[model samples]
Target: MTLDPNTLLAILAMAAATVLTRVSGLVLIHFVTIGANQKRALEAIPPAVLMAVIAPTALVTGPAETLAALATALAAMRLPLLAAVATGVLVVAVGRAVIRV
Candidate 1:
């Protein structure tokens, strides 16, 4: 299979679309003055977006994996964010090792 001119053009169009959608937020945010309630809503959005992304994956994982994730989140709460991620990864790795033995 080869990427011909038509295929290349399609790819370029898709890339442009994606870039525009992402940048649209920055453009709007720069020009628009959001009110107090809107600002609060915007602040809340990140956590809600994070939960939306994580909640499904967490629910689908096995019990041990879920426990490991919880441990990681708790650890993260106590330490820096990166440290928390590392702790969670370590927990999952150790849990898997113990299970396999």
Candidate 2:
């Protein structure tokens, strides 16, 4: 199947829309005044957003994937953030290799 010019344009437009939605808050923050209550809410936003992203993955993951994610999250909570991410990636990679063998 061939991708026509119109299809390519449509795909680009959809990608742009998705990116704009994701980054709109950062863009808007530069122009907006954040009050005390808003600031508190903003502080919670990262973990809330993370939970929203992670919860679905955790729920949908197979037993091995869930275990790997849990190990990564626990390590991240106790150690440096980057280390946690690395540990999680390692766990998932190792798990996948083991499953394949």
Off by over 4 Å in 2: 1-41, 99-101
Query: Could you list the CA RMSD of all candidates, in the order they appear?
Result: 2.8, 4.7
Candidate 1 wrong stretches, greater than 4 Å: 99-101
lDDT of 1 by residue, 13-92 (tens): 99999999999988888999889999999898986798688867876877557767788768966898889888888888
- The pairs that clash in candidate 2 are none
When summed lDDT is taken over every stretch of 10 residues in candidate 1, the lowest stretch is 59-68
Please give each candidate's TM-score. Answer: 0.68, 0.53
